[model samples]
Target chain A: MAHLDVSNVTKRYGDTVAVNDVSFSAKPGRILGLLGPNGAGKTSTIRMITYIAVPDAGTVRYDGRTVGPWSQQRMGYLPEESGLYKRLRVKEQLVYLGTLKGLSEAKAAERADYWLDRFGATDWADLKTEELSKGMQQKVQFIATLLHDPSLLIFDEPFSGLDPINAELLRDIILELRREDRTILFASHRMEQVEQLCDDICLMANGEVVLDGALRDVKQRFGKNTLILEFDGPDTFIDELAGTGRVRVNTRSAHRAELTLADGADARSVLDLALDRTDELYRYERVEPPLNEIFVDTVGEAEARRMQHESVTGTA
Target chain B: MNMSLRKIWLIVRSEYWRRVRSKAFILATLLVPFGFVLVAAAPAALGYLAEQNSSKTVAVVDQTGGQLADSLAAVSDDQLTFRPVSHPTDSVRAAVRAGTYDGYLLLPDSLLTGKGHATYYGMQGGGLTDQIQIEGRVSEVVRQQRLRAANATKGVLSILQSDVSVQNRTIQEVGTGADHTFAYTAIGYVMAFVIYFAVFVYGQYVMQGVIEEKSSRVVEIIVSSVRPFELLMGKVLGIGAMGLTQMVVWAAVVMGVLAGAAPLLALFLDPASLGVPADASSTAVAEAAGLSIPPVPYALLGWFILFFVGGFLLYASLFAAVGSAVEQQQDAQNLLLPVMTPLILPILFLAFVLESPDATTSVVLSLVPFFSPILMMLRAAITSVPVWQMLTALGLLAITFVTMIGLAGRIYRVGILSYGKTPSLREIARWATYR
Candidate 1:
């Protein structure tokens, strides 16, 4: 059962539809990646889910009840443009946010200490936020989100500022939260991170969901029609195939090429043709398209549809 | 619309602690009272120094050839000693130039017709106090001489020379009361100014606080857990409490300084030296000594707090709305002028309110919610205000503030999340109308 559900939610700002009939859910013990390009309504959807904003239409439910102040206390949201009070100490900042989330002062302090120790930030707990490095401040913000032990967590672009070491640590912590059966909504335009961490994915474009389901299912639905060829020699034959409309070239380089076969084109024939043209065919494989390709394809298709609709309706 | 008081309290506590611990808050809180103390003490200290330093001997060269010189010499005090000089005018002038005398007073002979003028020649001119003392003594001596020549009896002369002092009293329902007009005016003006400053400054602090949160992007995290209205109220209330704390500390400091300085000031000031009439009542003498400390108007203070809180909250919510609508403090300037106009307009009418508290203009202005905090306080301080007027002004202020908070909350909820160019007033109004 879904631990959090948003159904038929639509939010409009002035004449622009920021979120149009968006619907998605997060199940316990799984990470849901809300994937989108910039201005694709990912933040808007997260805002509605967290109750920072109310949907203009439809409902958001948590634990089989409409989301409200109760759900707010039980949820932790790290906004894309989130920050901490620059003049407040790390521990105090966490404690303040914890208390706002319904923890007692003493309990908030204890949790703050525990999280600070967990993140190896206990030494810098006394320092003001402004005194810390950007990565350290990001760690502090991450701790603030977990200090209340919220059942549902929402993080928007959580890894934008962290170094590799700290980012790895954050990834480990997020995985641990999943192990504890906490639902997570990770919203980002970073496709690689989403591919690595998300069990479920909801792809949005132009304020509408273009693709959504289990990550495996979403990939399978696209099929194994992509031909990845690694060869050293003339790649002129690959362009000839693309020009003939039998395949679409996604990427082309000196020694490698990625091509998506047409709807009825045979991957085996394309491979045989590639082998004949190349001087040395070092690698050849037929595989499903990567998430990056799928994301671009869907978003591009959605944009084309929107432009069509706008042109038809005489609206820009 | 589910609001949590606990969350609001948490926000308030954090906001309050954040500011109260800042070095700027501490400096601003303490510096104002320190300035007040310096202003209050400087003039009295200077007066004491001048009194100690001014002592001069003046030669009374009475060319009138009457008992004028003798009479002036007999009436000399420690600060100014008049010595009868028989030297010629040229030598007297030479003596003065040689520093043998501080100055020479020449009483020209005019055959008791008062046609010739009296002149004082000196190396350096005396201060105004010294000049008044010497001139008064010369005039009195001449007047006494002429009065005696006119056959006036001693009793008649005494009556002619004695000063008449008037005592101002106010009649009330209970009894007649001593008038402390000067003290009341001083306190009223200061209180009005303090309220005006507290409202304007603390309102700006709210704006700055909102801008800090929005610019820093912390507002998103905060609003997620707390309703925007709750957050807005918490900030306004928290900062208002901090301002009130500063006011309380200042009030205590002011009272302590006044209590400590009043006696010290009385010691330095002598009523007789100040030229108070010798035959005046003891109360008049005490007043002239500059030692009167009027009783604190507790009732007026209670009213002041009510208005200050109402006025601060009223402007603070609007300031917060302005803060949320803009990305930076500079962008808030155009919006701030309208919010600030109401707070500043009352100050312009402060003089009129103080001048005639019962005047219709003063009454009407005081009743205006925007102007009540300043004008009403001034009017109440200067005169007895009708209970209905006070209640009506407070009522209007309460309604306006509550309404403003509601409207501002709507604007703030939408504005804080918006980033980009500053919006216009029409856009803000449209935001307020959002469900």
Candidate 2:
């Protein structure tokens, strides 16, 4: 297992910065979630770490050594838009990828059969990849990533097309790898999965890292301003609280609503208002904002700022 | 950039095996040789069939008093049997019309002078060969009669009838030898065509392989473990090996068929029937009968392989770049023209090169990197190319392919990961400038 450190990395395509001064690290025994909206540079950052694309500036290091082909041998990356050779059989595809990662042919075949059996896809081994369903293809890709037993694992949207059962299976394997103390970087837009799996989280927006740290600590930093209310009456008081500019209603319905308390707003007052309007108050709790809200708040602010800057520059 | 040779080998092995095992590859590999066998054997088979159907018997009516019919009947061959009929002309015509004879020839007396036309009456139109045979026999008989009447000496007649044959031989600094110009030209043209076809076909295979990886989005995963250049080289080398395998199979099949078929063909064909001059030596008759198969130029074949490898790598790399820059096959059409132009230029100039392989223009064109594989091979086959020119052409080709591979690697590195509209040539050029 190795520590992956990407420092001050920037990647530009044409005039646009795809990954700008992005810095993060993942140590052994931890799952680092690379969270971002679409086009928020998560894939770009992962690519740099894997050495698929060279950064315009700064460095990507593994165990304090600059990453190169040697690092690549020890890193397994499952790209966001990964695919297999459509004409190649599943076992063949896995073996090719494993051998490319420096596994001997026999060992690759052995590992491939092992993984195929583990995924309960032994029957699909001789079938061409195109013959498999999208979910099955995803499972095969996951196996290919793990076949070489690399120290560092990077999976971008690994569970996107997988059914719940397969997703659960993948999650279990990832957790198992983490127990084995391998460094894992999981990049996805699914905040719930990230929250459930990641030990450390690095959130990016507008090609820059906006929030990053230990997941629990990052959530703690967001503070306990989010209120979750379950009630059984008219939700008019939720709208009334929003009108007062004391809270932001994230979602509202007649029976339940989630709201973020505005700065300097008292959670108790919001609860009292909700209690007064509802015929029955079932449950109420103040908690730190979920990663989903944090994602939106940080990326939404970054997008707004970019638009503002673009408008200003357009006029100038 | 560190490149893992092992990874590249793995890629090459996979690419080669994947295609070589495909039904399409097997069908194509086998079909080419089958088609070639069909083309090569069809005419010979037809000619043999026609020869079998050409036997005819003609009745001769002699009114010349010079006994021309007797002379013709005495020299009758199997294909044309002549019978001297003492019957009247009308009777002979009736006999021919009644199918007793294929035709009847009438020799009328005209004071022993060659002033009258001999009339042949047949049931149907005669074949050209039959007509020529009958006319030649009649003319020889009449000429002999005239020569006797004129009292010409036997030596003079022999001198007048002697056949002249000119053998073509090339005197070169290497050695003076009989020139198999026909065979060499044919083989040279075939080699050039094979290279042209292989380069275009295998180069596109490289392109298609690249595009498949890119469009399927598998390239990024592969590139993460292997450098882009190594990946590209692996693909090119792999596909090129497939092409070589197909060509070698074709060559072997064709050679095997020829080796097995030559004696069989000779059995079915008659040397005399092939129109070799009468009284010619047996060896000359055998040569004219095409029984002496020319030895294959293995050295030239060696050169052909060298140029093919160099040319394929050069064009396959460029094709891979084009494949990387496009998202679909249709988008590739526009970019293909530039790469295809150089390949086609050599073919367009093939006629000029073959017509005068020693011409300065041919020499200069053959030395050009893009044209050398084809034009140089043509020159080498048709004439003895000077050692310096061959070396220089090969050197230029080697340097060009290596440089092309490097440049193509740069473009491919960027283009494979990019998705959207197909980039303009200028934009692709800009990508090569990326760090």
Candidate 3:
């Protein structure tokens, strides 16, 4: 059974539909990327899942049953803007959070110590949170989230203030959690990070998921229209070259040009023709579309369609 | 342990340690005792030192050459050196304006004729004490002159002094319960003001704590793990514990100081030698005058802990709840007024009821749980309070404590995550009713 299944969820903030008909399933050993633009209903969905706010419509299931107090016990959440008491020491704050998550005093203290050591923050045990830098505070917050060893974890923009090294360190730790067969849901706009971490992805736009699937499958589907080319001279050459497919230049330089083989353009045949035109080509390879491009294309297309419909209805 | 119990303990620990260690709490706790000592002792200390080191010069301007000046000299504190001024009244005013003299008194010519009125020239609003001293001297002169004219004997003066004498004491046998000691009354004032102060200090600590969490959006993360009730209770209890610990330390310090200084107080204040006469009529006079022995310190201390904790928790919970309900400190003012009004009314009523802890006053203040702890402590200090009444007031207070927690929790649950306009009373009511 899936560890978490949020089905047909809808939430409204007064007249604003924050989350609209959202559905996703996070199975054990899987990291599901809940992707969205700012205010794109990702927080609303997470809030509903955590039971911080009740869903106006839909059910959030844990295992096979719907969410309940028992589910909340095993669920860990790191809110986007959460902070520790400014005057409280890092270790004490984590211990308090551990106790709140149902750890016994001894267990909480033990876990707090372990997490501090893991984050290389043992020396910071007695230092108030206010004394720690923003990156260090982020590490403490991360440790607090995982100290309880919750089966299902959700972190909203957990990498915000972290430096690259610490961010990678946190990423490795998240991957380690995934290796332990824990179900994780992370919301981030960093596509590269999401691509590296997520097993499945749900892309939310305008309070709705425009696209969702296994990460590899989604990338494969998104790859069909994109192509890469290597040739001498400028990109204007490819734009003028007639073909069975639409030619969109991906990149152009003094010595080489890259193109997307839109629709039916055979990459090898197109390259063969390009070879006939120039011989200075070094290498040409087809690669999967970057998640950022996919996001932009998908959200852009959806928005354009909406605008067209709105204009017809005089609501533009 | 269950989350509620664990969270509450955590909260208590958090509130206790965080606030107790705070410079603000330390400053506030120390402010009260220091303020009391300064207000009570500064004037006496200053006056004593002034008498020993410097003479208070008084300028006497006599329009008529009478023996009024001589009478004024007789009433001097020995350190008060009177300077006779034959100059115009304007000169005396200039001297006073120049700060040369504390004050000047102009005696009218008809002073001996019983139609005399004294014109005191100085800062009109200022020099009240100076005016009082001068008045006392003038009255003594008038009395002496009238007595001499009427040819009154010393027996008459003796009779007048004896007729107006007041002797006061407590009528209790050895130790029925205990007389309302001045010490006990002091404890009441201390306890009342302490509770008043501690509740605000600790409650504001809890309030600010909640506001910090709420404003930072940290409460959403916390409330996910713990119930609002546990969080509210934990904060109040923790801060209240810290306050009590500080209070005990301060009390111990005060007791130590008093114990070490008892002999000095006896030497200087003459307290042990200060006693009413042993006549039955004097005792009766003492009883009628409402004089009593000090309140039992141990009893008052016990009540102090009870009422202080109960009083602090009752208010602190509401304070925390209010903090949670609002996103900003400015919004908190809306919720703050209703909770504070009840507590303030009791404090304001303390003055009027101090002289008369009548049934009406006692019943009115004591029945209301908000006023009960402070008012009941006062009544208990001044007069006998029935055990049944105490129990009833305590029980009602306990119920009030529970009810406040319940309501505060409801508001806390809804308000912790709420932002923008402060919730109205109707909205809070709905939250309370939300099952």
Q: Cα deviation in Å at residue B198, candidate 1?
A: 1.5
Clashing pairs in 2: none
For model 3, the docking class works out as acceptable
Off by over 4 Å in 1: A301-316, B1-3, B47-182, B266-273, B276-293
RMSD of each: 6.4, 6.9, 7.7
- lDDT, candidate 2, B1-435, per-residue tens: 234777778778889999999999999888878787667666666777876787788998878873888889888877788999988778888888888899898888872687888888898888787888898889988888889889999998998778665543234355334456777887789889989999999998999899999999999989989999989999999999999999999888777766666556655655556565455555444445554446667789889999999999899999999999998989999888889999999999999999999999999999999999999998888899998998999999999999999999999999999999999888999999888
Give candidate 3's whole-model lDDT. 0.74
Please estimate how well model 2 matches the true structure, expressed as its whole-model Cα lDDT: 0.86
The candidates' DockQ values read: 0.63, 0.62, 0.47
Cα error, residue B40 of model 1, in Å, equals 2.3
- Find the candidate with the highest lDDT and give its number: 2
User: For residue B195, what is the lDDT in candidate 2?
Assistant: 91
TM-score top scorer: 1
lDDT of 1 by residue, B99-125 (tens): 889999999987356787788888887
In CAPRI terms, model 1 is classed as medium
In candidate 3, how many Å is residue A81 off? 1.8
